[model samples]
Target: MRTVGNDLVRHQLHENRKWYLLLGALLIIFGVVLLASLGMATLSVVFLFGILMMVGGVLHIVAAFKIFDGGYRWLWAIFGVLYLIAGYYAFTAPVQTAVVLTSLLAIALIIGGIIRIINAFMFKPLPGWGWTLFSGLLTLLTGILIIASPTSPFWVLGMFLGIDILFQGINYLTLAAAIRNIPPSSADV
Candidate 1:
């Protein structure tokens, strides 16, 4: 059994986790809102989000540099480089990102629907399968529509932003909530 001191340390560790989770939650919210607003407007939201990502990516690179003395410095540098590349892409092609986001959403929905249908079939339930099946079918139909007209710039951008923003908001909220629930660390003492 751990001593009381260890318990306190554990609790402190939990608190740190809570803080990181809160940060992640914020990121998710930002992504969703940025995407949604992009849908509502046009290039403004996309630019804003891209700029944000770029700034964050640059900061990450600098941090990685600081850890050069560590064993995994190369790995960190690689990650930093990858983020930089992504940031550059986001900055250069916000519009394309908007369209891509829409495509991704449709594909995700279709996959999710298929998975749900499969799950429903897996469980031998004689009742309450109607709703599941209906939802799955609807998702599949939406997916088909997305695939049928990937070139519709307006629809794709609008939906992409809106859906991205909403989902990101929800993601942030969830992460924040999870962080808030972690037990306090003993280190507080």
Candidate 2:
């Protein structure tokens, strides 16, 4: 008769939903804290930032897996490169990295606003045009604000980054948690 111990030798550990939840939460919080550091850092060891960046890139790539488009895959791939570059630069040249990120955010906002405006015009027999126009205006204002104070946009960056990561972590944890509530697979266990 095979004992439980014999089975234990071959049985794999069930997925630890809690562990992934903790990791996701930690990654999110850490990302924001690092952003708040604003090019100022004092790590006990070297390459910490780089390692964090690579992990961040991988997370983003994984997130992209749910998206349904070749374009999204490419986007995630490019995002991974950016993350690695950002992390490397943060560790090696924090000041420069800060400047670059600050500039990039401003540019991206401006372009996003322009795209919204273009999209707004493209819609005909305009349904919910008012909301779209309002959103566009808000986007423009955000872009302008960034342009006005690009040197120190940490407040905006920190707030937005924190909010985004917090929500993302919550969403992922929720999905994982839901798996537990569902019935286990019916396949012969």
Candidate 3:
């Protein structure tokens, strides 16, 4: 009446259970630390983002010269220069960078939410369209709230980061538990 598939996958997951547990524990610890030092952690995250942008810019510049042959190389170079300047400013003034980035994030969320809402309506014939619409509405509300309280970026960014980390840790833990609980058939290794 029913079929079971991929015994080897089950065995592998069982074998790797310890690693999953370890990862979950590590994430939970990091989440706790993030929550404890919310402001400092937020600042650190912003600075790290700046560093990543610089690295991305460098890579883009390199790719423009080495990877691309003709058309968009100059455009890539210009983008690289802009990224470098933005990264330098972010590193030099992390607090200000965080504020500016927060505003950008708000704008992005609003635009993305609007797009999602429109797409949901376009795809109304598909299953789970309501969920998509709900998610878009939630995103829209969150963006609006963030924009309304423009001055609370410091706390908002910090608290959201910590909460996200905590949820990630919980997700890992749940995944490990689910893997452990999976029933193996006779074909299992």
Maximum-lDDT candidate: 3
**TM-score for each of the candidates:** 0.53, 0.53, 0.79
Candidate 1: which stretches are off by over 4 Å?
Answer: 1-45, 66-71, 124-126, 160-189
Tens-digit lDDT string for candidate 1 (1-189): 466877776665555665656665665666666555544444654566667767777776777778565756667767767777766776688768766666677788889889778766766376877778778888888787877785644455555555665676566567556655666554554
lDDT of 3 by residue, 115-136 (tens): 9999899989999999899989
Q: lDDT per residue, candidate 2, 1-189, as tens digits?
A: 355544443232224566657867876776667556633322311245567897898777776676646888878878977887767777886555555565677788788887777777777357986677677778877878877984554455555555666677777677667756644432215
Candidate 3, poorest ten consecutive residues by summed lDDT:
1-10
Cα error, residue 82 of model 1, in Å, equals: 2.1
Model with the higher TM-score, candidate 1 or 3: 3
Clashing pairs in 1: 8-186, 11-184, 11-185, 11-186, 12-185, 12-186, 32-165, 35-161, 36-161
Superposed by TM-score, candidate 2 places the C-alpha of residue 174 at a distance from the truth, in angstroms, of: 1.6
Rank candidates by TM-score, best first.
3, 1, 2
Candidate 3 has an lDDT of: 0.83
Which residue pairs in model 2 clash with each other? none
